[model samples]
Target: MLKPVELDLSELGELAQVIPGPEPKLELSLSPIPQFGAERPRIIPVCEPSLTGNELKYVTDCIESNWISSAGHYIQAFERAFAAACQVRYGISCCSGTIALHLALAVLGLQPGDEVIIPTFTMIATAYAVTYTGARPVLVDSERETWNMDLDQVEARITPRTRAIIPVHTYGHPVDMDRLNALAERHGLWVIEDAAEAHGALYKGRPTGSLGDAAAFSFYANKIITTGEGGMLVTDNEELARLAWTLRDHAFSSERHFWHKFIGYSYRMTNLQAAVGLAQVEQMANFVAARRANAAYYTELLKDIPGLVTPPQAEWATSVYWMYGILVQDEFGLTRDELRRRLAQRGIETRTFFIPMHLQPIYYEMFKGERYPVAEDFCRRGLYLPSASSLTRQEIERVVDTLRDVRR
Candidate 1:
């Protein structure tokens, strides 16, 4: 049975008041989805991709053309379109977002024992990618306000071994790229943006991916513009792209087929994936609009609900609201996990924030004494609600009402 909702318009006015002043930036983009509200006005996944586009058409064309492999026109088209959209000069498609990061480090020739700064609150893939290059991921705590890397903590961590900084734009919100970039420029370090969760988000009126030296994106099925399972690395440096192109295809030199100039893993994105990705990119603007609207509605409905801290926006950035996350304050009478269980019983699916990299089993021994209070606290209290691009306004109300019911 569908529950009727009383829409709240009053709290919405608060939005305008918080609208960021110009420090710099612009836009949010479109994406894919999986509806979990099946059978019983059912479960709503934490994030879903909106697939209302020419996805089928373009994919069918690739199938008909028999170019489902890596070699095809769609590859170039997707690369060009995504690169242009991000205001970068080149987009080198890869097998996954993790590989995209690996490619960035690989091209920079990150040798063993080199250090790459990263936020502890990010997805494991960020750190894993650093490991892929035999480099150390120097983890830092997130800032409490935006749940992004604490830039102040970064400078102190840099040593002679530090080579790059990979800032995962946490939860679709842009990090303080200007400050990070300034720090990097001072230290002669590279900035690699792990923009997997932020496709069309902006910082200071500019796209996030372009703010760093090399940006990595994921086309996972749940991303804004998905290719089911793919990733891309965009940059303005011609030599870097050249190196990546060769690296993506097993390090083969252009002059010779099957001859290896260097040892490289095959990280190429298939033509079929590119075909779907092109269609998804074509619909990005609309997708971003839907996501923003959905997030706004969520904010409106949950405004008066005390003890819940909704996602915060920074004045210097435009968030994509990748997943409508909230932090359950201690006063809330329920633990974050407890609330999630309650929502699960109501057929609402939610996801907890990342376990800080320092706490992960694989990295525990490596970071035994290191502690990041902000990141650890978020891990304990943060969880995102249903934030699929395909979510409806009514669905947002249901999620809010259900949450209210849970608290009651």
Candidate 2:
């Protein structure tokens, strides 16, 4: 069981005095108000999709044309548009981002017992996708600077059985793609980018998805863009694109009806989802701009706080700041959990960074408490602020003010 930590905020009185007016009350009483048309305090979600008015028109067109299923024009349009945006030759839409990763693994010709190196600090789906392809997931620790796979550790883990590398762009920060790509080229290994959180992010002016041999993107509701639930796989190779297309729909062939050309899974995306995705894609540039601006605002507001270490942007990378995360300094004498609870008490939402995969129950039983100190440290110290695209400047100010008060 996880032990709870207590937070003492008495020291914050000095900091609270800096902000104008009385500090907000840390508690509120519930009122029995009517369900409809009642004013409530604004909620700053972690993310909110930017949907322009075109979504309903496209969705209605899909429904009216009786193309709401997997085989439809909207799906093809979305695939093409996304491929063009990523600067890749082809794109395959899948039911979800996890399936996109699985398809990339399948098309890479991974076999049983082969290994794929992945960051231990990423989401569980990264490892699961490799498992689905009958390949073992070899976890590597993250670097303290960027919260991404440490290239040194990755190189150390590569062996005869290592078949590929999946470098994830954690938050909106791009991984060290040049180093990872060079390593893959040297080892003759495939590079599959897990770009789930970096749709519009760039590295040296090139898009994240275009940096690898193949890349997977998520359009889940919490992402910078949403399609309810959807994903896309992009590749520049024609053969790989054809393979992904065939494998995503159960390997059906044109010449042979009901005959399977290869073993595959049903991972097709519906037209309804694609319609929503297409609309979101059209506004991706604007959404990315807003996210970058908001990140700048937060940095300007909180840079002076001695206990907070804001997210870093590498020289070669331009992050969209999908979520504004900070590492609480040890000098602050407070744990991330303590800070999270204090912020929550002030009606501010925050989230902790992902725990290293090695610490998960299943992985822990498999690896037996092997240490990856940096990843573990990040899990304990990193906290994410509210970064919804819908957040107004006033709301962001309130959040910053609350954080400033807690730091005192």
Candidate 3:
């Protein structure tokens, strides 16, 4: 069993007095040995892609073929491969994850006044996508255990205006898909999963994208796998895929040029991006494995710390651990902000978790007086550790050591 160590914040404050404040660091460093070279400050980003030789080769092939625009063989190849990976019938590539969500809403024919249930603890894009479709986003609190949408609260929030539910797999942890899907089925509501943060995540032996009617993914620079900037929508419905494709590319009819069938925005993915995506997709399994390994290492290092709670994996959910998180307990004697500041002074980069969207200014204006106490409290205390894939074992050790020192 792990023994918890109580943190002494009073000691930390006194130590901070002696600790030197932030200073401007040199941009580069030089060494006398020419061949040995010099070292630069390594930036441990939150997430990074692990590229393979095939990625470069595919880009070279795209250059050689001159299929560098939005339409190319690489696009179709990536879509097919990604769809296969997700165990879905079809996949449509788009310009961004947000655009993919927008496409999902549009393809589903969501209209003004329709209500979409979203988690308050997710990236703003989830709710923004619903708003883009001229629908209202009814935000729900997260489950304390998994940090995903609270299923009971979601069920309670459903109304006559509710048209869909977008359960975000936050930080690559799969939500309670079985329960969410069951709720959707019972209510006859559309299930469009906002899986932007969970590419290879699984629930009950099935991939996240395959668990819903439709799902969206992101390939932004910081994601586990990146295509520079791209996204994808996966679905088993052929007609929905066709609609998404048309809507992605200006809603043009395939039969004729410039034949506008419906009003749509140009959210197409370039062949170059798709080429990069195909390369990244080929390496996703390894990337996910590495991330999981890193999370395990973190858990082993910090599980004994008192006043700190590491992310918990659900019984039926297998998380990719895109970002390792730690919740500072009230008894810790240190606020999340204070911990973040102290870590920064030690040359470690850390970030707080998402601020619940329900408390945002825009949402406040819309809802006027609504409040989610649990979501609000979690946001005030949760902090994300440095879990970047580029982070080396030594760096992780340094972070853990610093954390241990602070607690002591």
**Highest-scoring model, lDDT:** 1
Give the TM-score comparing model 2 with the true structure, all chains together: 0.89
The lDDT of model 3 is 0.82
Ranking by TM-score: 1, 2, 3
User: 323 in model 2: Cα distance from truth in Å?
Assistant: 1.3
Cα lDDT tens digits, model 3, 141-161, are 888899998999998999999
Taking every candidate in turn, the Cα RMSD to the unseen true structure, in Å, is 11.2, 7.4, 8.4
Q: Looking at model 3, report the run of 10 residues with the lowest lDDT sum.
A: 24-33
Winner by TM-score between candidate 3 and candidate 2: 2
Quote each prediction's TM-score.
0.90, 0.89, 0.89
Model 1 gets an lDDT of: 0.85
Worst 10 contiguous positions by lDDT, candidate 2:
15-24
Which portions of model 3 show Cα errors greater than 4 Å?
Answer: 1-41
> Could you tell me the TM-score of candidate 3?
0.89
lDDT of 2 by residue, 209-301 (tens): 899899999989988878899899998989999999999998998788789879978999999999998898898888888888889999999
Worst 10 residues of 1 by lDDT: 23-32
